[model samples]
Target chain A: MLGSEIPVFMTNRNTITEQYPKIYLYRRIVQAKLFIDANYADNIDLDNISDEAYFSKFHFIRLFKNIYGKTPHQYLIAVRIDRAMQLLKSDKPVSDTCYAVGFESLSSFSGLFKRIVGITPSIYLMQQQKIKAQIKSSPLTFVPGCFAEKNGWLKNRNFRETKS
Target chain B: MLTKMTHISINVLDQDSAFDFYTNKLGFKVVVDVPMGADGRWLTVSPPDQPGFEIILTPVIRSMYSKETSETLRELIVKGSFGVGIFTCKDIFATYEELKAKGVEFTKPPTKEFYGTEAIFKDDSGNWFSLAQLT
Candidate 1:
């Protein structure tokens, strides 16, 4: 009676579907990535991230690094630093941005920021602010020369002149 | 006589997501988007400026492949085993910045390679591509 309830075509497909397909592995890896993206601000580690995909820690590390070109730890640090950069650009204080982006201490945050970004967070913040002010003062100077020249607008204004 | 190659096939996990990634994210134009019964769609797209060459976004579907084979192929894809192709842009830094701002994940940022200035980024389905500006 239970068998008769299924359509003939559905019954045939169900036999194939019953196999534990390997093709679904990509979905699990992607799910793990999505988990990282959503939880990057939280204090997460290799074990926590790997468990999201149902893979063992070592295997997950290898698989993640192979696909993403970085270990899970490295990728997590990059994500945190990227978020910190954005926060600093928005005028967030250096100390605040450290904790905001999941870094535990200002000293470590500043040190790591310098290592990856080539400048301390405070200096980077100041640089962004300066660039923003410059852009506001002379917007045309920021436009690509090719774009300005193609539109024939360069004939009217010299970007080099505006900079001074 | 065979004149030139016109199409390249790419294995995508999902055709619909690949469509959005190729068109909206990469700015490619669609060449064909037609249903193919249960196997999925015959979807192909080309670079915005280069309209002649097409990249087929072939989906690995249950109807077309044995469950075991699909599993193997999907595992390969997620492992970043495929380097689909190289795309050229006029300004490597500018293009790199633009694509990054649009949520493209770059495994290696723009670095000066012997062939040219190159950067590598992965698509939505975990297939990596070399984005370069040749010298």
Candidate 2:
């Protein structure tokens, strides 16, 4: 039987594959990187980057996708999803984890989480707990800084550390 | 209040240059080129598929008054410190290559986004355009 309560939080994985140099897209990417860095959790708009880039809501979406290669909302949601993933491994509740990463709709959050991770949040939670326990029992050694991390380049990886 | 984006207008420094650049380099369909009132203005183009999306091939009024506004605007575009960006593309990579080959100057080369490959290029008069891979 499934556990009495579903644990929250999923794992995190950033650094979406980029196949080109940033010289041409530096400005727009920087703007997006800034927005994502600052408001990946809070609501952010194109204008938030620079007045020159902002338009109406839809325009902003189009502009962001055109410049950044991903819709702002999609990118931001993915950030939260990645953060939730790590939290899941650490014993956070799925629903609470969802909100902590900025998702307000539980149903939507669950659906998207499953889509990205290939299983329902509940199932993933159970599997992660099992893995965590197994790993704890297994004898392992590591160097001073093993650097077991994902998207560590973002530096904001700390986003999940202080998250409730 | 809500309708699919039918068109957009951009101010240019020279109508003739804008016309040739957009039509020849960008391949926008030229739907009309009628003259307006005395001091009569002329020149316009539309996307072949969406004839309604008209681009106003008019000179920036400031350029006509003095070069100061033109210089300021040019600097802003260079710094990416101007207005909203217009992204036009079907397959952003191919279009990016095509424009890049046409001697277009770009702020950056194409890069992959979760949305698609994207690039930024500027017109002769310093108007910025973000070309996205058409999806």
Q: In candidate 1 chain B, what residue range of length 10 has the lowest lDDT sum? A: B33-42
Lowest summed lDDT across 10 adjacent residues in model 1 chain A is found at: A14-23
TM-score of each: 0.47, 0.40
Q: What DockQ number belongs to candidate 1?
A: 0.03
Interface RMSD (Å) of model 1?
23.8
| Candidate 1 local lDDT, B1-135, one digit each (tens) | 989987787989988999989976786877655443344555678996798998978776534467887788889998999998899986565456556656999997766655666788999989999998798
For A64-95, candidate 1 gives per-residue lDDT tens digits of 67655678888888878877987887789899
Q: Show how many residue pairs clash in every candidate, following the order shown.
A: 2, 24
Model 2 lDDT tens row, B17-121:
777788767767665443322212435677644677776565654214356875665566556664446556554544554565567887867655555556777
Candidate 2: true interface contacts recovered: 0.00
Per-prediction DockQ comes to: 0.03, 0.01
